[model samples]
Target: MIPEFWGNGIAANPDNYLDEDEFDSSYEGLLRLSERIGDAKPKGVPEHVIHTLPTKPYLMSKARSPDERCTICLSEYEHNDWLRDLPCAHDFHKECIDSWFKNSDKCPICRRSILENKEL
Candidate 1:
C-alpha cells in the first residue's frame, strides 16, 4: 500500500511515474525543490511585462510607409498626422502607439522588444 501523503503534498503515483495532471500541478513544487536543492531563486517579472520609455519621434523619420493600417487598434494614419516609430521601424498613430507602450514593450505587429533589447 502507498504511504500516507504529507509534506510537499504531492502524492507519488503507484503505476505511471509521469502523470500529466501531477506534472502540470508540480510547477510550484518543482520551483520549491529547485530552490532547496540548487539554491535557485524565484524568477523575477519578465522584461516583456515591464513598461519602458517610448521611442522618440525622430525615429519615425526612418520608418517605412505602409499602405496598411495600424494593427494595434486597426486604425489608419492620416497623410501627415503624428505617428510614433518603433525600433523595428514600424509606424502607428501617436495616440495608438502610446496606448500600446503603456501595456507592453512589444510592437503590436511584430512582437519585437521595444526596451529590453536594443537590437530590435
Candidate 2:
C-alpha cells in the first residue's frame, strides 16, 4: 500500500523529522543564543524622566573650590552657568549632564542612579 502525502508533500509516515539527539542539540543552541542576547547592556532612562531633574546657576561661594569643575566636561564652572542637580546631590553643567543622561541615568561623579530611591 502507498502512503498518502500530508498536503504540503511530506509522506504521512516519512522520517525527515529530527531524531532525539538532533532535537536536543537544536534546543541547546536556542538556549545559548538567548543567553547571549540577554547579556547585552540595557539602554538609558526615558527622556521625560531626565527632564524632570532640576537646574540652578553656579555660585562660587557655595561651590567646593574656586576651580570647581564639572566632572563630565572637565571645565571650571563659571558664575551663572546652569547646573543640573541629581538626587545624589552631585551636580553638573546643564548641557553636560543632559548629554550624559542620553546614554546613562547615573550621576557622573558618584555613579548614583537617579532612578533609585524615588518613584516616577
Candidate 3:
C-alpha cells in the first residue's frame, strides 16, 4: 500500500503535527518561566545583596564627584543627593541603585558582580 502523505520522515508522521501543538504549549511555559532570566532579576536572590552595598550622601567634594549625571535615572546629581556606591566604585542614586540591585547583583555600568570579592 502507498502512504497517504509521502515526504521526509517527519512530514510523513502524523504524530508530529499533534506533537507540535503540545510542543508549543511546553515552549510557551518555558518562555514564561525564564522571561526574566536574562538582564532581569532572577527569582530567589536575597535582599541583603543589595542592602549590604555601601550607601553615602552625594556631598560636593573635589573628590568622589559624579559623572555629571546619575546613570540609573539619567538625571543630574544635585548637591546632597544620595548615592549607592557599588563594589566596583561606580555610584548611582541611592534609590535608583537600590531598586536595581534588588533585580540584579551586577553594576549597571561596569557589569561587575556586586558580590565580587565580598564574603557572603
Candidate 4:
C-alpha cells in the first residue's frame, strides 16, 4: 500500500512547487495585499479643496465663552459665530479659515502643513 504522503504526491516530488490551481489560489490571496499597498500610497489633495482650519489652539475658555477673542485677528467671538477646528485642536472663525486655506495649506497660527507637496 502507498504511504499517505506518497498518495498525496508530497513525498513523490518534494522539490516541485505548487500546481497551477494551488498557485492560483495563493495568487488570489494577494488581492488584499495589493489593495493595502495601493491604499498606503500617498494621494494628492485637490488644489480647490478648501479646509476650514483653525489659526490658534482652542482653549477651554474660548470654546465655552462667547466673549473669547480669536488671537489671529484679536477680535472677539460672538454668540452663534461659525468656527472650524483642525486636527491639531486649533479653532478659528469660518471666514478667517477660508481665506487662510486659499492662500496656503498650512495652519494659520502654527503653520502645520495641511497638504504636502507631491513629487511629480
In TM-score terms, candidate 2 sits at 0.59
Q: What does candidate 4 score on TM?
A: 0.42
| Number of clashes found in candidate 4 | 0
**Best prediction by lDDT:** 2
What is each predicted model's overall lDDT from 0 to 1? 0.59, 0.79, 0.72, 0.61
TM-score of each: 0.43, 0.59, 0.61, 0.42
Question: Model 2: which ten-residue window has the lowest total lDDT?
Answer: 1-10
| Candidate 1 global CA lDDT score | 0.59
Q: How do these models rank on lDDT, best leading?
A: 2, 3, 4, 1
Listed per candidate, the RMSD to the true structure in angstroms reads 10.5, 12.4, 8.1, 15.2
Please name the candidate that would achieve the greatest TM-score relative to the true structure. 3
Candidate structures ordered by TM-score, highest first: 3, 2, 1, 4
lDDT of 4 by residue, 27-86 (tens): 667776576567554443344544333344333553466546665676877656777776
Per-residue accuracy of model 1 over 1-120 as CA lDDT, tens digit each? 434564333555455366676664478888876766884432322434332334333333346566556677776554566666766878777777677666566777888766655432
- Name model 1 segments beyond 4 Å from true: 1-66, 118-120
Angstrom error of the Cα, residue 91, model 2: value is: 0.2
Question: Model 1 — which ten-residue stretch has the worst lDDT?
Answer: 42-51
Candidate 2 positional error at 104, Å: 1.0
Question: Among all windows of ten consecutive residues in candidate 4, which has the lowest summed lDDT?
Answer: 50-59
Error of 2 at 35 (Å): 18
